[model samples]
Target: MKALDIRVMWFQRALHLWLLVWLLSALPAAEWLWEHPVSPELGDPGIVSGLLHGFGVWMPSGAAVPVAIALLLFAVIGAFKSRPWWIGALTWLFFCALTDRAWLANNGGTWLMRNALFWSIFLRVDPSKEHGPLSLVPIQVLRLQLLLAYAITGLQKLHGTTWTDGTALGIIASDPTYGPSLLPVTPGLCWAVLLFQLTFPLAVWWGPTRIVWLAAGVVFHLGTAFWLGIVDMAFAFLVFYLLWFPEEGVAWMMRSLRITSTANTT
Candidate 1:
């Protein structure tokens, strides 16, 4: 297989794994997210939600746990066999249904996952290369989506005093809800985050700076996971990073796992 194919395969596998983990984590919160006071309602927030509402597919509040369990099962099946593109489509539809119903619970991470799942519907994994070649358009779309997210976030931060004055991290660290007491937030660290977000879109495309930027992103997300207690959100963003990973990097990962050698020997 070519490097591009390898990267795409691994990207699909990693994305499937992330979805499985995400659904598993959300199992316990199923009732809270879909059955409580903030449960599903018939509303046309977007085309998809409108269609769902039209079809009377808005999941009933009482079915939240069962629906969540079904989605988890679909995720498990997708993780085992990524070629079933319908799995991705079904998952994305269900995700849209849940989020649209409980729009109050929607966040940046939720939207990101929605977009990723939408893109995944068009992707297929065929190691045998017997189904012809895969289109690169969806892959490119995911990459652009990720880059735009960072670029826009960084630009928006510039409009705020916290990020500009380098007090954003400090403020977040002091927040009672999301902050950790041990975080050593500083002005320089705040500025560094701003700069990294603004520069990532440009630097990550260049071979020389790609790895450096990717490593910085891993550290940035991991830090947010540990310090801000946003583990799911952090991992959600980190999963998109696989789309930007270089072919060589993917190969290195396969080698580390003995996958490449095992396949070669077979």
Candidate 2:
């Protein structure tokens, strides 16, 4: 096969593997909720570990992150844009962002902007290279991850008993584990959760409606953090969720990457 074909094959293989991972997660995600169970049972705690557990996604590429970065290095050395190296880098970045969320990485506004930067990065990608084509893979995959997370979160509310009535917020407001611990939310908070929960799935569809609800979502998650006064994790998830937006231009994104990339060119 030609080198380009080989690169395409590699990218396809990586995309397939990522999708398979996502597909396999459904049952396990639901089951894990029962087994590990991060409460609130609806809204994201906004932290990385809490968001990962609640979303049923395993982030924190862990030791795997460096390996992925190494692959990114090798891919760049050899110029293998078609090889899903970008996908690997994104997965790693997602994990790294998750870590930031877990520890309350920065001061209040600082973390918000920090995560927003990551969110913007998530939307951007570089696909122009002679060695390999920049498929729309990254943008699509990032959105898929966000949509999947929203679906699962919505599922939690739909399936849970506490969510059906107003009591879910009340129950969590009392629990601290399910909701924020710093300051408890009011029964009024449940209404906010309910509105967002009802609209979450709709936020994924393509259109102006998506942005509207998505903005509402940011407001909603931020509200949860502020009201409950637990900001970090919640903000990270929202920042991560912003990965769904459209990329302005792949060429610019990649050129920017070239300037910023730490790896050496072969």
Cα-lDDT of candidate 2: 0.45
Report lDDT (CA) for all predictions.
0.74, 0.45
Tell me the tens digit of each residue's lDDT in model 2 across 21-50.
Answer: 322332244323222333334345456545
Over 4 Å off in model 2, which ranges?
Answer: 1-124, 127-134, 176-192, 246-266
User: Considering summed lDDT, which 10 consecutive residues are worst modelled in model 2?
Assistant: 1-10
Question: What residue runs in model 1 are displaced by over 4 Å at the alpha carbon?
Answer: 37-42, 45-47, 52-55, 58-62, 127-134, 255-266
lDDT of 2 at 217: 80
After superposition on all CA atoms, what RMSD does each candidate show versus the true structure? 3.8, 14.2
Give the number of the best model, judged by lDDT. 1
